[model samples]
Target: MRTVKDAWMMVQSEYRGNKLKLVWASLFSIFYMGYIAFFVGIMMNEIVQSNEGHMAVDIMLLSITPLMGFVLNRSAFKYWSEDSYTRMLVYFKSLPIPATVILCKRKIMSVIAFSINGTLCFGLIYAFSKNMRAEMDLGDYIAFTITWIGYGLIVTGLYITFELLFSGKIYLVLTLAVLIVAFGVAFLVQMGGGNLFLYTILCSQEWGLLSPLMWGTLLVGMASVQVFSKWTIHRLKSRDLL
Candidate 1:
């Protein structure tokens, strides 16, 4: 109980420090997502009027916002892992805390933060589209928003682990290079012969497969948080902090 309480306090402190930053980030993302949605609505109108082009554009536009948001959150998490908060994490884990308790607090905080951002983004898009008569309904939008939050958490956790792995300057260059290549691969897959947009759209369908993917990602993220907490505690035990 004490450990859990401590973990909660730690989470609260972190959130309090970043509350303003979170609010601004949420606002920025909401506007950015709204802009993307507006652009998509225009393109959709053009395609409909011209009676040409595949439905892939629609898919790409819809999925791009979430994908971009997820990656941004991951990058942010990586950045934060290098900050003082992570050093504090080492200390926190060294205490009598059950690793899972700390892990849960972090995950819960992440979900709450990401969910707020996702909700704002969705709200902006919905408000902007009030006059456009878009085909999307409330239930579908809510489900997609949840999926976005889940995927963001998973990606953020993975990035946090990598940040720990490459804490030094030497590995930072390698990390950037790898991320560049990853983005290039994604671009090639989508613009090359692959129809990634179509797949994204299919996954967004009412009976789509995104739910399973989201749940699987959440489980994987939880496991990763546990592993990382253990490894971090072990690493800290080997080093002395004056």
Candidate 2:
């Protein structure tokens, strides 16, 4: 398709100058994530063993563990700095490409990146936890991978929207604020008792991979990417590039 060709061209263009650096960065990210996953696996193994009655909480923790790599690597390094991202946007804008195509490429890239990273990270966790008392089976590992990749897509959509709409400083401030609020709410929920959200997700897993809840979550994530892409296109058309 024309769109696929355009996206491939865009990817090549984006990586034209610094392909080696990007590759190295990606390798480092994988290494760091693997290292962290190993420790987290051990910790989760202990927690699951200790919390015999709270299987829902354990499942919830395991499900979201893949995201920890993203958070950790993001704190330490960036795959694309703001200046580099700005330059890429400017260059792409000057080209004879449609906004939809540009945005579609980004979404597709995000999905691929998260898919690879999430799989490797989760695989490490699963491998490391094999000797533990409360280890998950192969089926649970696969289910968690599918579920969290959906969650990662939703995050990627929001993060791309934020990058488009705000400057570096404001974006960083807002990101920190969002993280603080999320952690605060989650902590409060834990202090009050077990998380209702976790319980709901855990219950949803009863139907295995065919669960409507799981599929619904994936659909929501995909819909979010589409909505965000459209919104970004509109914003770009309506305003001057930063």
Best by lDDT: 2
Q: Mind sharing the TM-score for model 1?
A: 0.59
Which pairs of residues collide in model 2?
none
lDDT of 1 by residue, 1-242 (tens): 67567767876785488877656656666676677666655654455345444444534433353244331333355544454444545566567555556555655555554565566555665555443235446655555445555545545554444444444343356546645655665566656655433343334555443456545655775676567656654554454433
What TM-score do all the candidates reach, one by one? 0.59, 0.79
TM-score of 2: 0.79
- lDDT agreement of model 2 with the native: 0.61
The C-alpha lDDT values of all candidates are 0.52, 0.61
Error of 2 at 65 (Å): 6.8
